[model samples]
Target chain A: MTALTPPATVTADGVIVIDHLTKRFGPVLAVDDLSFTVRPGRVTGFLGPNGAGKTTTLRILLGLVRATAGTATIGGSTYAHFTQPMRTVGAALEAASFHPGRTALDHLRVYAPQAGVSDARCREVLDFVGLGPVANRRAGGFSLGMRQRLALATTLLGDPQVLLLDEPANGLDPEGIAWLRGLLRHLAAEGRTVLVSSHVLSEVEQTVDDVVIIARGALVHSSSLAALAALAEPSVRIASPDAAGLTRLIELAGWADRLEPAASTRPGVAVLHRVTAAEIGARAFAAGLELHELTPRDVGLEDTFLRLVGEGAIPGVAEPRLEGVVR
Target chain B: MTAALRTEYRKLVTTRLWWILLASMAAYMAFLAGIMAFALTQDPGSMTGGAPGVEAAPMTPESVARTIYTLATSLGYVFPVIVGALAMTSEFRHQTITPTLLAEPRRTVFLAAKMLSSVVVGLLFGIVGTVSTVGAGAGVLALMGEPTYLSDPIVVRSAWLSVVALTVWTVVGVGFGTLLTNQVAVIVVVLAFTQFVEPILRIAGGQFDWSEGMSKYLPGAAGEAITGSSFYADSGMAAGLLTSWQGFAVLLGYAVLFAVVGRVTTLRRDIT
Candidate 1:
């Protein structure tokens, strides 16, 4: 029942800092000694599989669930200790409902005053999430996607500088997904920290600036998305009239590792080793090989994610019992 | 804390269920009053039991006050209890507690706001319902050639004190609701214990003088003490029940105990 000590620093720029947080549900270690920092002004995608403990970690950070053995702080204070929590950190942990009989406007109206937000802010947030027209409608009849939008609007009511959303895109349509992505980027642009957890890595592939992937209740990789992309092996596709000559040139260049030929649809084409396309083109030019086309096949985020989780690139830990569920 | 209380009050006022319950309370009380007025007007001699010159004891202030007290004390206990239970249970059932806690992370503020709103609405509805019962009953009684007036001190005091008791009852129900955290459980337990078990125990206790002392401590007896009518005393059980202040103190003690326990449980437990 004792409260944890506050962290050393509380700043708007330091959105969240976790120091070896651990949470256990009975015998199950839901989240292990997981530590990561989410910087301000970027969408940090908390990437993990279904049982990878992403939600558990977020719940611990929000103080919704007590950590069994470590501390997490936001703005240098535990979430429960924040005097004005709404203005400091806005979180939507799960899809929770308001009374179905209450109108959308009434729902926010009741909660807004407690957060010290003006009534006008409720309408503004509704409009911000494109829920203005249905503001007066009863929330019980709203579609799941509409509820998702309202939930987001609820989080935005206090105009918090940090946002934590768990699987926000779960029920969104394509247009809604695009809107959310743009909205997240817009929030980040305004120097607000946004941490969004999603099982679908492809959805956040373009939306997030950085990612912290976890598997089996432990960190697997923590780096910028661009850095992960750079670390991925590249593929080079080359189309040439003299395919054999180009293959011989690639072999001579000692880039024969993991080389495979192109499909028949592109006749006289040789897909060279899993090296950067620029390097393959540079070698072809040096060998005086005639090349009709050279295209670099960018690695998909799914591949990088699988590689990280599968390879257990995380710094430390014993094998977890739930490792099979991570993939 | 004030802002949170305002929000809670606003929510309770705007909720359609609260309005529906209020209307139902009024209708039930009015219906009962109408029945009494009709019976008294139609058969004027029945009330006086054929006493010579009794001639339909003309709906005196005491009679009207008695009716108002009976309705208020009885229905007052039931309606406020239901309303208070719903106030908290609805949030839990609808999963609105998560957002509410998020908005006001200090659990104490949320519970206090809810308690304040319940007290205000309970008292307001109690007064409105009591006054309507007396007014409607008096009107019908007068139209039926029987006279009743609000000027009687006892009638006025009964109406006012009923409001206080109803408010206290609402908070008690809310405390039970918080402790149980289940709407059905609170309703069932409150209804069964207050209506059936307490009266039976009071009766059984009367047969045995040793148990008579315990009977006065029952909720029904304590509640009757506030309304200035002892059903057990009339039934030949106890000589005297608790005084008004003593009864109020007992009810308040029960409410505060439950409320504190509920508040502590809500603060310590996970929102999920």
Candidate 2:
């Protein structure tokens, strides 16, 4: 399960496959020729900007919405084929999917029998999500954060093997977010397949092992988080009192084109792109240049995400890797 | 299937709408039946609004009992229809269908469960309607020193048939609600047709021979025919209507038609 395959190739138990999926709502295309695979025993972040078809893709996978073109399947079968769907795959598409008039316990009770769970299990899940105190309160009176917890509790009624949660942290506070991160990590640690969707990369950065980012209903980049990090340009930052000598050494080595001038407020400091700190250190020593500090700097994932979603410009990133998998 | 049915029932009972509608039906049936019984027994001549030369004919005891008992279907049928329609439409209106369909992905089986639950709710409303209408109407008849006829064979049959008629009406509401899938729109159409449109059409059906032949098949008319008695049918207006069994078949056919059409058309489309 730890083996990380190239983008769009990995498949195993609890894997989700979306192939050539196209959904057109009248003249406007919601999802266009999108394809990706989500593997089990890890948390995969489905990242995209708002209105980028993330919900539409998830809805298609769960059989709530019909696809216009291709297929979305779980474990090589459509969702509707499962005799016990809630047990096989637990999905919470939105927190607002609840009827406001029902109490939290009653809401779970409604689905518990269908999920083949006991009434006791309903109470257990309510407690698990920290909603036990208000289990009998009408959902309409609960706060948005409490409603989100209730939605999550409903998904856990079956203790499903696969979990799909979209924007699960939308209404949560900072503490609630931290709690969710811990909960997601715990769920994934149990070898369950977890795919969570969000528009903000940083919001899921600490939780996701892999990411499948899309924009305008198309796959932008799909790879392990480490692989995506490797796409950033390596650079080195050096500060020295003998800045003139450092400049001359860089000029003589024909590396001046990659050098960015030091900040005016902080003289005698420069950053060199496309080079490691070790290389800069060895060259500076050879030229007898005294360096006060030398550190490697890698661009953060937030930058990469913004660039992928067409939200910002990030120069020097390689053309995103693409693979066509028909299956 | 059993699980789906249980879940559907739980979904219905968890809300206050069903009982609220049931109570309203009971109250409305009692009031309508009591007033009708009083008018019929106290001054039979006033039934025609005292129109000149239009003397109200003296009604038999059996006919009076049948008319009073059948009010459960003739007047209170709309309650079960509303109850049944809301059973399905609330899922859409509240967006609860997302979680519901997620839990049970087989759309057909989900709909089957909804239909079954509608039958149960319909039966419940039928019982409430019957007890209130019969209890109040019979009390009025006794107060007027008239024969209640509560145990008369035809009168008894009318009471039971009224229950069956209300049950069928509930199923009809479910079918149309599924086809429409919009709570507000379904309720509007149901209220308009049952309260205004059908009454006018049924009355107009009596004015023209061509329309009268076709009007007997309308949903409300079929309901009245199934009960085998109604204040309207007591007059010459329902002279050429279909037989009682035929009315049952016609009303049941409408239920099936609405469900099958809804199943193939709107219900099969994407929920989102």
Candidate 3:
């Protein structure tokens, strides 16, 4: 029951827009022609693997890094246009970016004034982030989870309309993660724009409403979580004493196209995509195939992420179809 | 702008570095002034002022007072510079610049606030350093049965100018620190340039009439000139220093140059 700021008025003011954002550090392309929109009232996950330009894109949006080409704006303007940026968009880039010598309160005090906040608000934010008990403790002695909480507290100092967090769940325990998920959902419900970035999709799989994924400095997929899940072909795992006969029976029934050759690692086993377990069971019964085991398997977000990044062996295909992927 | 300044001031006070620098600076000024006062009064002209060709002038009560009161700038200016430099470098050292810029995105305003706040702390450093040097030097002079000359106009002016000089040094530190983002590198450069390189050049400059003209414009000489009373200059060891206003202008020039170059070259660059 850490209470945060009152809900923001529902509007387009907190929307973050990035149009053809490209960044090049000397010879390396960090973000390439990236474009996306994070709207209000939703928890959008900016997902990508490590070095997939997730952090770079956030940095550009925050005005920490200069975009080589294109623009990133919040509320129809660049981050630099805001006089008191913290009040508009509070960002938590890295958790360990605290001065080891400063207490958590002192750290907040340093930015409170610039954010147009009072000293009492610093204490309030520390309390809201569940760090009220250790408000006087130096950040150096705190645990990683505590530091992460401190960073979040710092972002909440101004009660910003938008929150851009980079890997917020990095060093949290399971309980802490659950607490964070609730807090994020609460903030999103408050009509605030929450864009959280993480390398692994599973970490934020349960929390995010929309997903924007990238790989190798280029956009791969951007859609609702349900839309990404729709790309996953539902499959049924089947194991029978007459696996060869079952395969031939399915082939004869014109369901051979659904067979996943990559998933069938051994004889007497086959995985059929886009088919229900009951249909498979009825078909095996009709074919008089000896049954051993049949179970429906749902593809998790982790597999979808790996497949999107061209790093995982897609279900039925021997080679990953990295080219012409959904973008 | 006021909020930015307040934030920068808060940033300085929350850390231990500023107070530590102030304490050390006061101690250094007092000890150095005390030693120089004792040596000068005990045996006049016994020690050479290290001028290669110029004859050393014997110490008098008036000159001794002037030199002692100005020790804060002549010898203790580095402390304020360290204070100012650390203020900027700590952000980089801890990667706190991310949040700092997030709060105030205007780079020029952020740097300006840093400069202004450091000036405020620099003024404090100047007060402590001048007080210690004047107190110890006057005490030593009084112990030697010599007039401390505390109320003399030139002596009083030197004391206040010493404070101003140290304040300017603090601005110089901020600029240098901004230009050199690496904490260790900035510290090393500040210590090296102030302690070894500049002093050697200043001393060697006095050895020749040609170098003397140019050496008087060096940062240390400019600082000492602002006070209008350097132990070396007053004792006839170094000569042809700039007038007080000229010294002030020159010092401010250095501050502006370092700050502008740093702002353009490094401060505006991507902060990753």
Candidate 4:
């Protein structure tokens, strides 16, 4: 087996083809003509606002909900048509309950046979998620974080090449989040296709390689994280004893077009034109102006996400609102 | 298929409701037997004044055995129906069907496994109910100087066939539960049809010759046919009422019809 296998490295070429997928619940269109490709070996963050059809699209892709219009195929087959689905795609859509009275080991035991997973593999996955010690305990009393870990463990039981997780970090603490980031990275390194959907843009910033954003049941932006960040103009913040003098110097330097005062009550601080920190600093020094601080603010993923999804996308299309719950 | 069946069995075994239902069935059988035993121990001589009336006969092992079989089979169906209904309804109540369907994907396999498991559990409960009734009856009848021997083929066959009848009845309940997919609705429909409507129809069928054919198809009347009893003895149709084999076939047909309807509904409907 070892000699016949080549090294596992996910290429950017593996694509998830979603074509003309549409789903409607009465008057509301949950997912409307939504289409996107999540490439392999890259952590693709599916970002959207509270009711932007993120979860609905994922459900349709998983074949949990039938689409009203189109098709979502993974590796050229719908999830329902896959003969060895567990081996092809591992999905964790929601925090599912295994009989509350059953121990964790027993819970997995019932599913392992159907998934074609062995007993040893169950132990391996349990160990992977750090739940080996609590394997014999009833899952009813498990903490939310532990339940999330167990769900992840169940998802990994099939050793699938593709992963589709919806809000995998919802209940996790910071340390758990960090652990998840590492685990996802490790999985990607092993050439698996990992797709994660979350509204928390900051949480996925360092973890995801690319992003596919949607709003109002429509695609907003789809691109690499770096490319999206590069579109953001650099803003400079200057703190000086002489605000007037700094303003004059900045105007003379031909960077006064985008200049604005800093929105703070403190005196002697002004926001300058959207220019690089280095350029502003050199000009201030050249004009003999005293500058206490000159800092560059790089746009974060959150800024890009909000701007693309909140401001750019069309309004008034009703996506399924997760009432009183973070879905 | 075996894996699915195993999982279903595991789920049923682990559920507290299953155990409670089993205990309830046992308790009901014990209660029925206790009443019969108490009645059998009473002096038949005192009631008849040591004289034989035209319509009355002395209690015998065969007569008591027949009564026990009738009581056990008739009363035994309630528990199995309740158990079967809860088995399917709990998945919907707990919202566990989503994960189950996601795991299996093939809807038919999951449903078939559940149906088989329900039938097996129903069969087991039937046997337990029959044994408890017969054991109680035999012990009481023996003490009363009317001993029933195990070698009597008719009595043995009655007990065994009672089990078969009870199993088929439970499967019918399972099918109804699957079709309705609501615990309250299924239970209500089952109780209404079996208790009030069927009995009234059978009484009407006995009085009116035109309705006799219709009454024969009613579940309770059909059930009576299996137990070798006729709800309409005055109609003269009781003597030619369905034979045991025919009764078995009719019961099986009811079970099969319900099962197919349940299966189709389960497969076509959205689990959520």
Worst 10 residues of 1 chain A by lDDT: A1-10
Fraction of true contacts retained by every candidate, in order, equals 0.58, 0.84, 0.85, 0.23
Per-candidate TM-score, first chain only? 0.77, 0.80, 0.91, 0.83
Which scores higher on DockQ, 2 or 3? 3
**Mind giving the per-residue lDDT tens digits that candidate 1 earns over A53-121?**
888888677776778888998878888787667777778877656788988889889887777887788
User: What lDDT does candidate 1 reach at residue A162?
Assistant: 85
Candidate 3 CAPRI classification by DockQ: high
What DockQ, between 0 and 1, does each candidate earn? Answer: 0.44, 0.73, 0.83, 0.38
lDDT of 3 by residue, A1-327 (tens): 444665446689999999999999998889989998998899999999788899999999989999999999999999999988888888999998998989999999999988888889899889988899999998989999999999999888888899999999988999999999999999999899999999999999999999999987788999999999888867888888886897787788788788888988788888888899999889889888888888999878788888898854337645547778956
Better of 1 and 4 by DockQ: 1
- Kindly report which residue pairs in candidate 4 clash with one another: none
Ranking by TM-score: 3, 2, 4, 1
Find the candidate with the highest DockQ and give its number. 3
Worst 10 residues of 4 chain A by lDDT: A1-10
Which candidate gets the maximum lDDT versus the true structure?
A: 3
lDDT of 1 at B177: 75
Docking category for candidate 4? acceptable
Instruction: Give the number of the best model, judged by TM-score.
Output: 3
Q: lDDT tens string, model 4, B1-272?
A: 88788777766776567668778777788677656655645743222243333123455646455656555565557777778777777677655676667677777787778778787888888888778877776766677776565567776776777777777777666666777777778778877876677656665565566776666666655555676633233123222246677777777677677768877766566443
lDDT of 2 by residue, B35-105 (tens): 98898887664565544443455667778788888988876788888888888888888899899999898
Per-residue C-alpha lDDT of model 2 across residues A41-129, encoded as one tens digit per residue: 79999999888899999999999899999999998999989988888788998888778888999999999988999988888889888
- Descending-DockQ candidate ranking: 3, 2, 1, 4
lDDT string for model 4 (A12-97, tens) is: 43457788888888898888898888887789999998789988888777777788898998877787876656666778877755
